[model samples]
Target: MEDCGEHEGTSELKLGTTIIAVEFDGGVVMGSDSRVSAKEAVVNRVMNKLSQVHDKIYCALSGSAADAQTMAEIINYHLDVHSIEVGEDPLVHSAATLVKNMSYKYKEELSAHLIVGGWDRKAGGQVYATLNGILTRQPFAVGGSGSFYIYGYVDAEYKADMSREECQEFVINSLSLAMGRDGSSGGVAYLVTIDSETVEEKCILPAELPTFYDPDTIES
Candidate 1:
């Protein structure tokens, strides 16, 4: 069984089932599968991995479910307080920095991977990831156990200047492909798209698999 959280000197943490984000010409697309597992067993099938911090800012959580939820709540609360005091929402970069700091502070105890992305008034749209206390800005990012499969599709299909529609399709196809191959990943899919002017969200049902027929069964 894989350890989901850090304890004493344990450094390994279970990855979330699947979460992916892609950057396009004007915005970013983030998607996650709704599956949670414990070892070889599926514990929950409707877990949401994507969180909305504000109207414009959002994040995808991967790793221990408890840790991810707790950290998300903490970050949301902090952002809420900051907005109330400053009379405006923080930029996407600032939000990523805040999460990076918190992750670093609790690096020893918490085992959560975060991908933050959103539209910034000054910087337009951006995405960033936090891993083991280090924060990196990425053109595209994938997390969880199925990330390897997701990356395969993304690397082959992603373009530097894809249209918003194209990017959305790419994200959906990548996630569906991942779910099909990764045993630990499957369920409903949640997608969020963020641009300079608006943030849009959509929910996608699991893809239907095609029926396979054996050639040997056919009569000549």
Candidate 2:
């Protein structure tokens, strides 16, 4: 995990993290690990990386914690104003664009990557990824240093026609895989599922995480 940037007011360097978002048949699933680190120390163990942009729209945050959170809050405010002006929920694309614009404008000062997804009247469900000013709509998206460990796994396992249950499982399994290998990602896994009618949030404790390998069989 590389040092991304300094934490809000401290000299500690905010480190790596893991965040993911996947679009399923009926909705979208987003998740992340709860661990927050600074340099070689764990500064926070219960941070919420999945933040709501609107009632149904959400974004998974990575990179500088303060920068990412501040950006999300700003986007949420803008979306709220837009929704009121239009008398309707903001579109997923519009929310993603706002994130992209902010990231691009502050590319020099901010180091954050966001995976935005949700369900709206126009788009039943959508997922978008924004980083370094580039915005892309994807069936699924993954970010952060822990993400480096699971690129092959994601590519091999992802399916465009996955059901809601399958997508949720996929997200949990992916997070567990990365957490197990990446020093910078661990603790409980937080998840959010957004559909047209409702938004559901869940958490998987470390003890409940799936075991990918037999600890007893590993070489000392």
Candidate 3:
């Protein structure tokens, strides 16, 4: 923790999962499904699932939903505070410091697992997400039930070499693949990208199912 908030101490909780990120082309995309099931039964409570903070960035998280929500609120407040003080886009690093502190402030039992992405005005491009236990940014990150699968597919496929549209397609396809294989994940997805203007929202694309054909028509 480079700089954490004032608190007695705090720990983290892992709850519903998610996958999200910033891409090479200065855009952002986030994805998460509405599946929190066990033993074929599901949790009845509704969660925000995925959202944008500061109107300039997007986030998806896995951990204590309660904690994640509160942290998000604090982050929103901090962004406003910075905007007023600096008269410019809030620096992601400043947001990180605030989240780090807030997490510790509420660290006793309610701690969130989070990932955030945005456009860094100072850097003149979109910033990727990193996982350091705070609301800070990273180059690439994934969360949620299918996160491991989500990360695996994209990590291998994503390249600074790919075009913005190409990267977006890869992310969409990767998420669909994750939903298909992971029982705890399903439903549609939402995505985004942040640049100077911020591409902050996109519709989720469901996984592609293989087509079935008549056996007689098969070339094999």
Candidate 4:
């Protein structure tokens, strides 16, 4: 993956990019673009950045593919153990807290950014983000180099009361805009929505670019 930036006072390489999560009326939506880059070169075209930590909990990773993958596996393992011991699935916030605590342990050596979102029976839908070992719960979160483009679209278009379908469209549109403007972001976008009853995922291909119109070319 491309090195977008480095953490302060550390040589830990940060790579991969572009992850977004938003909470809507009835559920939460999270997604990421499929492109993986290294420096100026594209390394993989179909990388999956989103991971299902539990039946309803999902995490999106951005930075250091190895670290991200390892982190997800560790979190998932913990969640699984919790579920088996408690006789119930862990809450979304619990999962986020678990990740935050684990992240702190590797703060100096690992450069990884994560967006965790899910739906819980008692809490409804929730979203959280982590950066430089600091994790915060948010209404929405964006990470990676392409986040600069995503924030603009989200600021203007996102609505907290939107439905699942609307949120999906908004996420696809936001990712498309980012891919168009950010060289490090591209490929198909994958979305996951978690509600009280179920979790759903969809793949949205890049939208077709608008065709230019010329006033002088009119012909009846």
* Cα lDDT, model 2, residue 143: 94
TM-score of candidate 3 on Cα atoms, chains taken together: 0.73
lDDT of 1 by residue, 1-220 (tens): 1225444577555564788887776678898888887766788887778999877888898878888888888888889999899998888887888889989998887878889988877777788988877888888888888888767567888888888888788777777777777788888888999997778888887644222334478899
Alpha-carbon shift of residue 129 in model 4 (angstroms) = 1.1
Scanning candidate 2 in windows of ten residues, the lowest lDDT window is: 1-10
Quote the positional error of residue 188 for candidate 3 in Å. Answer: 1.3
For 54-97, candidate 2 gives per-residue lDDT tens digits of 98999899888888898899999999999999998899999999
Residue pairs in candidate 4 whose N, alpha carbon or C atoms collide under 3 angstroms: 1-37, 2-37
The list of candidate 2 runs beyond 4 A from truth reads 1-14
Off by over 4 Å in 1: 1-12, 208-220
Query: How many clashing pairs in candidate 1?
Result: 0
**lDDT (C-alpha) at residue 60 in model 2:** 93
Which model is ahead, 1 or 3, in terms of TM-score? 1
